[model samples]
Target: MKHVLKNALLLFGALFALALAGCGSSVTDKSQKTASLAAASAEFPNADLLVSADSVQKSLNATDLLIIDARAASAYATGHLPGAINLQHSAFWAKGRGLKDTDTVAAQLGAAGITRQQKIVIYDNTTASWGAAGRLFWMLEYLGCTDVHILDGGWDKWSADGRPTQRAAVTRAAATFTPSVQGSLKATSARIAGRLYDNDFAVIDTRTDEEYLGWQLYGETRGGHIPRSVNLPYAWYYNTDKSTLRYQQLKTMLESRGITPDKEVTAYCTAGIRSGYAYFLLRLMGYQKCSNYDASIWDWADNTSYPMDQAPNYADAVYPAWVKALIDYHKPGSTSAAPPQYSYDRNHKYLIFETQWGSFDDMAHGWADNSYLLGHIPGAIHSNSDVYENGNPRWFLLPDAGLKTALGSMGITPDTTVVVYSDSNIFAARLWWILKYAGVTDVRFMNGGIQGWQAAGYPTETTINTPVATTYAGATKPALLASTTYVESVYNQPTAKMVDVRSGSEYSGMISGYGYVVNKGRIPGATWAYNADDSAGIYVDADATLRSYEEVKSLWSNLGIDFSKETIFYCGSGYRSALAYLYAHLMGYTNIRNYSDGWEGWSTNYVEDPAYLATPAVPGSTDGWRQDPSGRPVATGGL
Candidate 1:
C-alpha cells in the first residue's frame, strides 16, 4: 500500500513539472509575437516623408495607397511590385530647359491617376546609382502632394525579399492633381550668378570631373564650369553597391566641403537631372535654404556673356613663380636665343593649310579654292600645299630651291615663328615637317590644329589678307629625315622601335591603297602601332583634338615603346605619320624620326625588284629584300 502511494506522488510531480514548462513556452511565444508586430510596424523618423519597404507592403491593399514606379517606362514594363503605376521622373522637367509648366505637370500627374488625397509611395529600380526616386519625391512635394513618401531601398529591397511582383500594367481612375509651385525651390540663372561669389552661398556643380573640368564631352559651346563653383558629383551620395544612400557619410562629405546647412546651397548639372537628385538629398538632410539651379550648366554655358572657369586654370588658380617665369620666357621678344617650343598661344604668325586629300571634300580642297573665305583664323595667311610639291606623283616636299621660293612667296622667313593648322592636321604636319627640314628655326604645329582653335572661342575671319613676299634662304636638316637605307639598318635593332602609324588594315597586309604596291605587308621587323582612338583613326575627339597627353603616353607605353628607344613613325605617303612625328616631338621624345617617303617609297623599291616579290612575304626575313637598280636599293645590313 505504501509503494502504491509513492508511485502516485512521483507521477503527479512529473505532470506538475511538465505543466510549468508548457506555461513558460506559451508566455515566450506571446512575447515573440509582440516583438514581431512591433518590428513590422517600425516607423521612419519622418514617416510622413519616408516609408520602409515593410510599411509599404502592408499598406499595398489600402484604398488610399498610391504606389508609384518612378523608373523609366522600359524598366517598369519588365516587372514591378503589384499595383504600382509607372510615372517616369524625367516627365517632371521641361523638354530641354527648366521645369515644365505647372498646369502641364499637374495634368500629367492627374492622368497617371495621382490625386493629392492619396497616400503616395514612390520607388525606382533602386539598383541604379541615380536618385530617380528622390527626384520624383521632390517633384511631388513641389506639386503639393500632402501624404507623399519614398520607399526605402525601393524595388530592389522589395523584390529581393521575395515579395510579389506583376508584369501586367496597372491603371487607376483619372483624378485631378493641383500643383502648388514652390518658387523658393528653384534658383534661376540670374539668382545663381549673383550669389556665385557670395560667402554665405555655395554653388555646387554635380557633374563628372571631365565635365566639371570643362572637357565638354556633352557638346557645350565652351568647355568650362561656372565661376566660383565647387564640384560634388551626385554619385557620391550613394553606396558603391547602390543598394541605399550612405546618409551619414554623405552629410560628412558635404560638411567637409563647406557645403554646410548654414549656407544657402544651390546645385546644378548639365540640365538639372542630376541637380534635382542633389536638391532632394539636401532637403532630406534638413537643409532648409537649399535650391536647385534647374536651368543648370547647359543654360549657363550657352549664354556666352556668362563667366566660365576653364580647365587647368580653374584647378590651379595660382601659378608658381617658376611657371610664370616660363610663360614670360616663351612670350615673343623675350630676348632668349632659344627657339619657341610647341604653343597654343596666338603669339606667332598663323598659317592655314587646307588640304583636300583623302576623304576631305573636293570643294574645300587646298587654299586655291578660296576655302579660307569660308572662315580662317584671324590674321592667318592661306598657303597652298599643291604649289609646294615637286615630282611626277605630286604632293612631295619640293627640292631646296623650290621650297625656298615657296616659303619666300608666303612671306615666311627663316626666323619667323609659323603656327600652322589645317582641318585634318595631316597636311599641317607635312608643312611643319617640311619647314623644319628646310632649316626654318621656329615652326610649331597648332596643338589641336584649326578645329581646336575654333572650339577655344578664338577669333575667325572671312576677309583675306595678303602679305608682302620676302627673301627666304634655307638649308636642309638631314637629321630630321630618315632615308630608306637608314630605316632598314636600325629597324631590327633592340634599341629601335619602328611604329607603323597606318590603319590596322594597311598594317595587316589586308588592303594596300596604293596602286604601285601590288603585294601588301608591313615593313620587315616593324611593329604595327596604328594611330587610332578606337578601330577608327587617332582623330576621334569631338573637336578632332589629340587625346590627352597622358592618353597618348599610355598608348605608346602599352606597345613597349618608351623614351629609351629610338622611335620611327611612318604611314601611307608619310602624311599621317608626320602628325605622329609632331606628337612625338611635343611629348619630349629625344630620338624620334619620320620616314618622310613612308610606304610609298619603301614599297616602290620592292615593286622595282622582281627578286623581292619572288620570295614569300615574311616579316623580319632577308628573303623579302631585293636590290633597286634605280640607285634606291632595299636596305641591307642584318640580312
Candidate 2:
C-alpha cells in the first residue's frame, strides 16, 4: 500500500509538471495586450498541428489559445502537456450519464477560461484514436467556438519528441468568458423526429453497419437504425484501422450515397456522441449544411410514434442489389438485424409462476404440460426474463415512455397487478426493476417465480390471450430517480450503501475507451458484489416466492455487506444490480434504491452535487476538500 501510494504521488506530480510546461507563458504574456481572455469576439488563431511540445510552448504565449486535455482524469493526472485543463469528453458531453444539459457544459467551459475567441487545442494520450478528443472538439464547435484544433498524434508524439514536462499542477490566473447561445448547431429529438422520412435531408447513421441495420447494440437492446437512415458509420469517415481519413476519398464515398457537400446532411447513432465526430469532419471539410442528432437513435427508437422501417432480419432477408455493391466495394459481409427490443410498461400487473427445468425451454415445456397450462392464474402473462433484456456487456435502460406504450398495447391496464414467476424470480427481478423505473409502483417479483408456483400446482396457459389497451397515468416522482445530485449526497453521507454488481475491474475503473469514466474506482464507501453469486438457490418452493429473510441475511453475511444499511444498487446502467434490488425487496428491504444512472452516469460525469451524497463531506479528501478525489487545484503548476 505504501509503495502504491508513493508511486501514485510521483505519477501525479509528473503529470502536473507536464501540463504546466505545455501551456508556456503566452497566456501570461502581457505583450499580447490587444486580445482579452474574457471576450467572445477576441481574435483566435487556427492551427491544425498542435502535437509538437515546443510548438505548443510557443503557441501558449498568445493568450488567445485554450489548451484542453482530452483524456481520462487518471491519465491527465499522471502526465499531460502544460497549461491544459482536463476537458474530458465523457464528463463534458455524453447525455443521460449526466453532463448532457447545455447550460451545465457552458458553465464548465466558463470555469476553464475558455472563450469563443480563444483557439482551443485538444489532444489525447492515444496515437490516433480521437474518440473523446474529437467529440469535445465537435461540442466546442457546436457551442460556437470557431477556432479549435486537434493535436495530431496527441501526447504520444510530444513525449516521443522529448518535450519539457513538469511534476506539478498548472495554475492559471482566472479570466471571465461570456458565451452566446446558438441553437442552430444543436439538433433536438423533435427535430430529428420531424426529418426521419423527409427526403430533403439525408439521414446518416454513424454506428456500425450492423447497428445501423438494427442488429444488436452494445449487447443490450436489439433493432436496427432509424427506418430509412443510411449506414455511414462514423468509422467510415476514417481509414480501415480508424486512424485518419482520406478526406477526398471519404467525400466521394459519401457523395455516391447521396450526401453532397451542398445538401443538408444529418447524422445519428446510439446516443449521438459518435455522430458528433461526423458533424466535426463535415465542418472540417467545408460542408455548409450538416447537423448531428444529439439524442440519436436511442431516443428516436424509444419514441414509438417515430416511424422506422424494420431492419431486414439478417436471418431471413437477402442482401439488396444496391447495398451488396457497397458491401463488396468496401468489405464483404451482410449487416445483421438487431433482436427485438422488448418494450416494458408499469401498467400491467403480471404474475409469473416458476417451475423446475434444467433449461429455459424445458421449464417452458414443463409449464406447457402442467394442468396450469389448461388455465393460468387469472390475468397472468408468461414471459422469460432472458427475452426481455440482453444480459452481457451493459444492459441499456429501457425508455420509460416506450415501456408504458408497449405495455398498454399488450392489453395490460395501468393498475393491473403483475406477478412474474420463474423457478426463482432471479431472472424476473429485471422486470421488477424495469417496472419501478418506468413508474409502475405496484409491482412484485414472485419470490421463487415459477418454481414456487409449480410446487403449488398452479395451472398454466398454452394459449395466448389478447386484452384491450387501457390508459395508465403513471406518477412522475423524479426524486426517486438517480441524478448527479442524489448520487453525491448518498455517497457522502454513508446513509445508503451503494452496491455495485459489476466486476471489480469495472468497479475499480480500469476501462480505456470513449465514455471511459473518471475517479478510477467505485464510489468511495460502496459495497461490491456480483448478481450471479446468490441467484441459483433463491427459489426452492412456490411459497419460496417471497425472498427468504434468512437467505438475504446469509448472502449479505457471506459477502461481508450490511443489508440493514439504506441500499442503493447500481451496475453499468442499473441492469445487473436490479437483480440485487429485487432480491433485497423480496427479503423485505424497504428503503433500497437503485441508481439508474449507476457508474455509467456517475463516473462519466462527476459526483459533486450535494443531493447525490447523504453526508456533508467525503471520507478521504485532503484537508477535507470538496473537489473530486482525483482532482487537484488547477494552479499547482503554472506555465
Candidate 3:
C-alpha cells in the first residue's frame, strides 16, 4: 500500500508538472493555473501536501502520511475521506484565539498529531473553503512542518473523480509541533507610527481608489488616504474562489503595478481586518517585509494630523469603460414601483435638530454659528461623534461606562427623548446607537439637518451663555443595545434586513475599502440604498421630511428588498445609513436596528456567507459612478 501511494504520487507529480509546464513558454506562468508540486517544493516546500488518495489507491498501501480535513463539523459529520482528521477553521479562531500568537498555533498543531518526520496532506471543500486550510498550512510551515502539501482542488476535486471514502473516524496519538518565531510577519500600530516617515517603507493603502482620492467620507472624518501610500486594493489578489490566488500571476501583476518584493510594504484598510488578509497573501508570495496596518484607514482618518493625499484626477477622469457598462446595465426605468407597505409611524414624535458641534471642525463652525460657550442642542446635551474613551480614531464602539460618562457630561439622561444631528448623519446615528446601546431610548435625528432648521427659520443664538449644568445618569441594561454578538446572530438569520447605504460598487464589492474586498459581494442578506437625498443636497435623511413613505418603499423594493421586516442599516461607519434608519423610522418599521460599526464593523469583526443581492448591478444607476454636466461617466472615487 505504501509503495502504491508513493508511486502514484510520483506519477501524478510528473504528469501534472508536464501538463502545467507545456512546451517551451515559461513553466512558472502557466503552472499557476494547475497545481504544481515543483512550485510548492520551491517557494513553500514546508507547506506542500504530503499524500493523496491516488497514492493509497494505486499503491494499495499507505504509511507515514497525515490526512487532515478542513471543514465545518456539520459537513465533516456527513462524510469525509478515510483517515482524515477534522480541523474546523472557525473553531481555531474563536474569540480568545489570538491570531498573532504563533505559540498557540504551534501547540494546536502538536495536539493534531503533526510531527516533523511524518508527511502531511490537507484538503477542504474547495479554494474558498481552503481559508482554514490555508491558515493551517501557513501555521504548519511556521512551525517548521516540511513535506506538507495541500490537496489541489480540495475534497471536492478528490470526490469529483470518484476517490475512496470512509465513514468511520480514526484518532491518532498527538505529535509535538513547536514553533520558534523567525520572520517579521506581524506589525503593530506602535511599530508603524515610528516608521511613518521612513522612506525605506512604502505603505499600501489597500482601500478603494475612491477613498484614496478623497471621494468618500469615513466615519465623521473627511475622505482622503495616507500620503505617499499607493493604492493596491487587496481584492486584486483573489479570483472567483476568494481563497487562493494564482501566485505566480499575481506576483507578476503586482510587480507590474509597482508592488515589488524588495520594497518594505505595509497594507491598511478601513480597520485592520481586510489588510490582515492582504498581509497574509504577501507573506505567502515570498515577500518578507510585508505587514498589515491593523488600525487601517479608519485609524489614519480619525486624526486630522495624519497626512493625506487625494488622487488629483479622480473627479474629472472619465469612468473606466467597465464602470460605464455597469451603470448602463441597470438604469432605473419608470416601471419601478414603490414598496408595498411603506409609511411613517405616527406614534413617534420629537424635534430633531441638525448641529455642527460633533467634531473639532464642526465645533468650530458650531461656535461660529451660535457663539455660545455651552456645547450643543437647546434642551439637549453635548455628544461628539468621537465619544469612544479608548481613543480609537474611527470613533469605534466604547464600553457602556465610558458612554454613560460622556453622555452624563453632556446632560443626557434616561427619558430625555433626545434629538441628535450633525454635519454628517453617521455621527448622529452613531450617537443614537451608543445611546441605545447604553440603554437610553427615544432618539431622533433632524431629518433635513441644521440646514433644514435654519432654512425653516428656527432659532439660533450668537452670544449664547452657559446653561445650568445638568446631570445625566443612565444605567446599562439589555434593552439599550444590540451587542456585537447580538448584531452578528441577527445579521446571519434570514429574518433580519441589512441595508448598505454606500454606493453600488462598494456594496457589490467591485470597489474595495471601508474594510472589504472588491468583487466579493456583500453581507448575506444586505440591501443597498445608495444615500440620503433630500432638499439639503444629499445629506442622509435627518429631519422629519424624509423621502415619502411611498418613495422609500419603492426605492428599496425596486432593489428587491422586503420592507415589512426587521431592518438594520449601515454604511462605512454608520452615517449615511443613519438616513436609511431615519427613513425606516419614518416609514413606520417596528423593528429597526443599525449596525453602528456598519460595513466597517461587519467586514472587520465578522465573516458572513457570501450572498449576492438580486437588485440592479448597474454602476451610475446604483452609486459609485458619477455623471458629468455633459453626461460623461466618471469614477467619483469614494461615496
Candidate 4:
C-alpha cells in the first residue's frame, strides 16, 4: 500500500504544476515552447499509467499513438490538442443505463480509432467536468486495453501550458477493437444485492447530500440511495478551489465515513460517472479490493425488487453525546430552573413586538429580518427600530413627543402589557430598554426570543399586522437611561462598573462597529463583560434560548462583576449592551443602566469633538473578559 503522506505530497506537487501552467501568456514562440518543455519535464514525470502533457506533445508525430479528448463535443470543437480525436465521455454511457455494453463500447472505440494495439492517451477539462478522463481510463482498462494512459492534469494543464492546439476536427480511419471485458472490475445490481449483508463488502454512494438523503429525486423512479449504502460525495476529495485532490484530507474524510481499504468497496452515484472517479482514487491509493457499480442507483432504483434506503439528512446525522446533551438542555420545557421573572412566554397576554433593524427585504442577509419573515410568533408586530432615531448625525433617542407619537401609532399605551422579542435578542432588549426609558411599565422580555418560541412548536406567521393607532401618554424615566457624561464618570469609578458588551473584535480596536463608530477602541477602564457566546450576535443556547440563569450569572461572576456595584453596559448602538443590562437586572443586580447610545454614541461624540478623542482613549485588553467557566469562548460562529 502507498504511504498516505507520500501520496498527499505527490498530489500537491501535481496540483502546483497545473496552477503554474495557467499563468502568463500562451507558449507560441519557439523559445517559450522550449522553456515550457523543460519546465514541464522537470515539474511533471510520467507515472505508471499517467502521462504528462510534455510527453504527449513529444509523441504527437508517432503513428501508433492516438490521443482522445473525453470532454463534451462543444468543448472539443472549440479547440483541441493537435490530431486529437473527440470521443465525448457521454458516448460511452449505456443507453438508458449507467454502463455501456461491452460489445457496443468496443465498437464505439474502434470507430474512434481506438485499437487494442494502439497506445491511447485520454484527457478532459480538469476543473469543470471532474473525472471524465479517469472514467474513460477505467473503462479502457476494464476492456483490457494494453497501452492506455490518462493525461496527468488533462486538457487544463495541456492548454494552460501553451501546448499546440487546432480547431479543425481530426478524423481517424476505423480500426478493430476486441471486447475483452474484466467482469471483476464492475459490480452488477444482483452482485451488489447479494453482497449487501457480507461483512467484507462496503457500498459507497458518491452523490450529493440531497440525492443520498432522498431530499431530491434526480431522474430516479424514487428518491434516496441503495439500501445499506454510505454517502461520501466525490467533491469532498477536492480542495475548496477545486483545483486538485487533497489526498490526506480525502483519506481522513473517507476513513471517518468507514470507507477503508480493508473492505471490498463498490462505489456508485446517480450514474457511474462520479463513481468512476472514486474507483480511480481508490485504485491509485492502493485499495486493492475495489470495484465500480457501473449501473449505480439509477438502474438499482428502476427495479421494483431492489430495496432502497433514505439515510438521515445532514442535520439529522448523529452527533457526539455532549452535543446531544446541549441540544436537549435548550429544548423548551427541558429545564426546570426558573427564568427571570421579567421574561415572558408565548402565552402571555401582552402586545408582542418584534424589534428588527432593517427593511423587510434586507432580512435575507441580515439575520434579524430574515428570521421574522420566515416565521415569527403569530401576533407580534414588526418594529423597524432604525426609524426611531436620527442616525446620520448621531443616534439620538427620540424626544418625548416623537416617542409618544411613534408608540401611539404602534397601538402601545401607557397601560399596555408589552412583550418584546427579536432574532438578535439584543434588538428586543434595546427596544425593551427604550420602552422603559419612555416610562412604559409592564414590559417583559421574551426569555429566549423568537427562536425559543419556535423551538417550543409555537405557531408563527409571515403576515404583517396593522396596529390600531392609539394615543400613548409618554412619561420619560431618566434613571434607566445613562448619558455619555454619566458613562464617562463611571468608567474608572470604584463603586461603578462600566461593561463593554461588544464583541472582542469590536473592543480590541480591530474593527469599528457597523462602520458608524469612528474609533476602534473601547471606552477606557470599562470591563469586557460581553459573554463569549454573544460574539456571533446574541448569546443563545443550542435551541436558540438564552443561556440558563446560572450559566449567565457565572459568566459575569468570572469577570469580577457583581451586584454590589452600580453596573452600566454598552454595545454598538446600545442593542447588545441593553441585553447585558437586562441580564444583569434579572440576575438581581440592584442598580443597572444602559448607555442607550452605546459605543456608537461615545465614538460619534469623540468624532464630532476632537477634544473627546484627545481625552486618552482606553487601550483594549482581554484581562477582564467573560468566558465560559470551562474556559471556552461562549459564542460559536454559526447557527
Candidate 5:
C-alpha cells in the first residue's frame, strides 16, 4: 500500500507541473522549497526559466526557437526582437478571463506556426505592459508546453542593455498544434470557494490597495477583496521605473507575506490580468503548489453570497475612480480623483464646488504650479469664498440677496446635492457653512482635499469648468447663524453650550491664532471643545481625512461640552468654527450654530487686560497678530 501511494503521489506531481485547475495541488520537499523562497538559493531554483538578453540574442538564429513579443502591435511596429513575431497580448485571452475557448486558442497557435512542443520565448514591455509576457508564459505552460520561458525583466531590460530590435514582423510555416488542456492549472470558482477556509491554502489578491480595501474599480456587484486573502499588489514585483526585481529581492519581500512553498496558492485580481503575472512569479520562484484564478472577482463578485471583506457602506464617501465614473457624464466632463454611499451616479444630481479664497489667478500666486492646490476635482466648478463675503475687511457674510446671486451663478439650487472641497478642511467647511447659511440643504464636504484625492491614485484638472446658472429659491435658514447679540443672549443661558474651537493660546488670551485678529482670549461662557488652531492637526488623520464622528464626540465630551443643548461654535473669524460646526451637523446634533462674528467681534466689547496694554504691541510674523491696547473689550481666560 505504501508503494502504491508513493507512485500515485509522483504521478500527481507531474500532472500539477503541467496543469492548474484552480486549487490543484503539487508538492516538493517542503524544507528545500521554503529555503529556496527565502534567498537561501545562490540562484533562483528555476533560473533557467528567465532567459537573459544575451542568451536570447545568441539563440536568435536557431531553427527550433521562437521569439514572441507579447506587447501591443502598436509598440511592436516601432521595434521588437530580431526575428520575433508581433502577437498582441489580448490574443492570449478574450477581453477578460473566462471568455476564452481552449480549442480556439489551440487553432490560433497552429495558425501562428506554434506546435505544442515548440521552444517558445515571450517578452513584454515590463514598464508599461503589466506583465504581458508572464501572462503568455503561464498560458503556454498550462497547455502542456514542455519547455517555455520568459525574458527576464522583459523588453525594458533588453532596451536598456542596448540590444538590437527590428520593426518588421516575422512569419513561419503553419504547424499542427495539439491541445492537452491542464485542468488542474486553472482555478475554478468552486475550487476557490472550497479552499477559502482551508488552513493549508493561501489566496493572494494582486490588485491595488484601494480595490482590496473597498474602492470598487470594475462593475463588481460589491466592492472589497476575497475573505482571508493576503494583499500583494502586482506592481510591487517591479521597481518604480518599471525594471523587474531580481528573484532574491522578490523572494525576500514576499517571505513576510507567508507565500511559502508549503501552501497551495491561488492568485487573483479584478479579472486575472495581473494575477496571471502572479502565477508566473510563483512558478519562477520554483513553487510548484500554485494555480491562477483566471475568472477571479469578475465571476466571484457577481455572486452576493461569495462573502467579501471590507465592502464599503452606503454613507461612505466616493473615491478618485468614482470621480472618473461621473466625469464621464460631462462633455468637458470631470476631473480625476477617485467614490462612497452617497451614490455618485449620473442619476444623482450633484453640484460640485472647488471652493477657494480667491479666483484661480489669485490662488496661483500662492500655489504657483502645485497641482494639488491649483487643480480642481473632475466635474467641479471653481467658487471663490471672496465672492460670497461682504467687503467688511474681516470676511463678514454677505447679505441674503448677494448670497443667492453668488450661489445661483454656480448652478447651486437649495435642493442640489452639493460637495465642496478646498486646500484644507477649514476652507471646505467655510463653503459648507456658507451654502447652508444661504439655505442650501444637503451640502457635503470632502475633507481630504485635492492632495488626498491625488494620493488615492485619482486625477485633478487644470481646465476650468463652466457652470450653468440656476435660479436658487429657498427660505433662508436664519437660525443656523449666530449674530453677536444672539450669541450673547443664548451663550450664558443654560439652554446653549458655547464651543470654543480655537487654539489653547487663543483660548487663554496669550495670542490670537489669526493674522488679522489683534485680540486674544476665549468667548465668555465658552468651553475649549476643539483645540485645532488652523484646523489640520489632532482632529485630522495622517491620511488627511477628518476624524470620525465617534472620535470627535468623545474628544468633545472629555472637554465637558454638552450634547443635549444648542451648541454654538466659535473661532478667530468663524472659519475654524465652521469646520467644528459641520462635524456636529454630520454627527446629527440637531441644534448647532456658527458664530459668524467669532472672537474678532466678541473682543471689541471687553477692555484689554492691563498687563497686555502696558506691554508694547509687537507684530508676530508666525501668528501675524499684534495685541491692541485701543481699549477694546477683552474677555481673558475663560473656561
Candidate 6:
C-alpha cells in the first residue's frame, strides 16, 4: 500500500509539472510505442532494441519523441528525420579523449534533449559509414537509457522507401539526464591485451581483411591487428540493400565463426566507432557478455611490447549489388545514362563473356534441364575456345587474320572493355591473355568466376546474348607472349625467371598432363610454381576462387619467382600459365609474359643442349627429368 501510494504521488507530481509547462503536446508515452512494436518483440528476444521507420513515421507528431540523427552535421543540415537533432556518433569516443566521464556525457546528451525516461530513436546510414546509429545506441545503453532504440535500416532505408524528411534545424527544451554508466560495456585496451590467447574469450576485429593483414590504415601506430583476432568485418552482416541480416541465417553465420552467446566476445576497429556498432550487433543477437574495445588498434598498436601478427591473404571481391548498381544506376530523367563501366570513362561500352571450351551447352546447363540454361551472369555471351584457338589436339592462338575473324565475330574491338569468367579459372584467364595479346585495351577476369557469383547469393541468368559484331583491326602485343627463341634466351638467365605453373608430378616428369602433349620432360631451369592440379589443390581457396595478393606472392616466392625478376610463365599448353600470368599482372607486375609454346614447344621442338640431355635425367625433379617431357602439374589447382 505504501509503494502504491508513493507511485501515485510521483505520477501526480509529473502531471502537475507538465501542467505548469503550457504545451504538453509532445510524446505519446512508452506504453503506446510498445503496443505498436509488439510484433518485433514477439519475433525475437531483443527485437525491441530496434524500431521500424514506420513507427518513427507514426510518432513524428510527438514533440517529446527525441529522434537523434547520428551523422555528420553537414548531412543533417541537408535533410534528416522530422525533428531529429544532429549528433555525430563518432564524437562519443576518441583516441586522445578516450571514453568520457559520465557527468560530461550526460550534460551533452541532455543538451540534445535526451533523458533517461523519454522515448528516443537514433538513426544513421547503418550499412554505410560503419553504422553510426548502432554506436549511438550502444552509448545510450551504456548510459542506462531503458527506452531508447535504433531506427532499423536507419536513414538510407527510410529515405529509400520515400519516408518523411525535413531540412529545418530542431532545438528542443533541454532535459536533465542522469547517467547510470555501465563500465562493463566498454572494454579497455588493457583488458584485451591480457585476454589475447584465452580460448574462452573471442576477439573480433571489425575491420576489413586488408587492414587486419598489416595495412597501416587510420593512422595506426603499427600495421596489423592484435595477435589471435578474427576479422568478421562490419559489412559482412549487411545485405546488398544495406540492411542488417536478422534471424536464423544470421545466427548460423555468426556461429560458424565461433562467435556465440557462450563466449565473452570483444569487437574492435581502428578506433571505437566500428567496434561500438559491433557491440550493438552482438547484444541484438542475444549475446549478453559482449563489449567494445573502444581505444582498439590505435592505442594498442602504439605499444611496442603488445603482440601482433600479420595474415597472409584473403579473397578479392566486390559486393554483388555494387555490380548491379553499376548495371541499374541512372541519373536524373534529364541526364544521359551510360552502360556498366570498367573504365574511368563511364560512356565506354563493355561486354561480359562466359568463356568456355567447345560448345555453348558446356558453359550452360544441358538443353533438357529445367534450369533454362542457367549458370552464367546476365547478358553474357558464350565465348567458345574452339572458334578462337586451334583445338582438337593442340590449344594455341590462331594467326592474326584468324584471330581477327574469331574476335570480331564476337563483337570485340580494341576499344571495347571485355570481362571474362569460366567454371575453370584457367579458361577465363586463357581468354584474358588472348584478348590482351590481341591488343584489346582493357579486359577484366572475374577471379572468383561463377562460384564466387553464386557464393554471394546473387541471381544469375542464362540469356545467351548475341554479340553485335564489330570489325577488329589485326594487332598483337608481342611482349605479352614468349616466342621459342625468346624462351631459350631467358631460359637460364639469372635476370629472368621461367615459372612452370604445372602440377608437381608433371614437373617431376611422371606424365604429360594432357593426352595431346606426348613430351613429359620440363624445361631444365624452370621453377616449379604449383598449378591447376585438381588433386593437389594449389594456389586457390577451397572453393577454387582466386587467392589473395599475399598468398599469390608467397606461392611464387616459394618457387624462386619474385616480382623483381622478369617472369616467363608456362604450363603443358599455355592455358594454365595464362591464369598465373593474369594474377601477376593484376598485382601490378608488368615484367611478366606467358609462353604459349609451353612445355609442348619446349620438349618437342626446342634445340636442347646435347650435354644436358646426354646425362641420365634425375627422377621427380624439374630440370633433370629423363626422356619424354611429361607434364608436371598444370591445371591441378585452379587460379
Across 362-465, the per-residue lDDT of candidate 6 in tens digits comes to 43454222222556777778787888876645566787789988999999998886777777778878888899999998776665567766765777886657
Least accurate stretch of 10 residues (summed lDDT) in model 4? 625-634
The regions of model 3 sitting more than 4 angstroms off are 1-62, 90-97, 100-104, 116-118, 125-127, 146-148, 159-162, 165-167, 196-199, 202-248, 266-284, 291-639
Between prediction 1 and prediction 4, the one with superior TM-score is: 4
Screening candidate 4 with a backbone cut-off below 3 angstroms (N, C-alpha, C), the clashing residue pairs are: 363-370, 532-635, 533-634, 533-635
| Model 6, runs deviating above 4 Å | 1-42, 312-639
Per-residue accuracy of model 2 over 509-553 as CA lDDT, tens digit each = 564111433334566666666433233334221233332233444
The segments of candidate 1 whose C-alpha lies over 4 angstroms from its true place after superposition are 1-48, 126-129, 313-639
Task: Quote model 6's TM-score.
Answer: 0.54
lDDT of candidate 5 over 538-631, digit per residue (tens): 5664445665444566678878788788989988777888888877776567688999778876654423456644553455311222234334
TM-score of candidate 4 against the unseen true structure: 0.47
Q: Tens digit of lDDT per residue, candidate 1, span 168-262?
A: 99999888987777777788888987788889898888775446644555556777688767667665555533444545665666785678889
Cα deviation in Å at residue 474, candidate 2? 51
In Å, residue 455's CA in model 1 sits off its true spot by: 31
Q: List, residue by residue over 500-549, the lDDT tens digit for candidate 4.
A: 87777777767765643445567766778664334363355433444434
Per-residue error for 108 in candidate 3, Å, reads: 3.1
- Give per-model CA RMSD: 21.4, 28.0, 24.3, 18.5, 14.8, 12.8
Give the TM-scores of the predictions, in the order they appear.
Answer: 0.44, 0.41, 0.36, 0.47, 0.54, 0.54
Q: lDDT per model, in order?
A: 0.64, 0.53, 0.52, 0.66, 0.71, 0.71
Candidate 4, residue 136: how far the Cα is off, in Å: 1.6
Which candidate do you rate higher for TM-score, 1 or 3? Answer: 1
Q: Write the residue-wise lDDT of candidate 3 on 202-308 in tens digits.
A: 66666544455454534626566675566655445444433345567667655754578887887776655445545656665667677655445555566666666
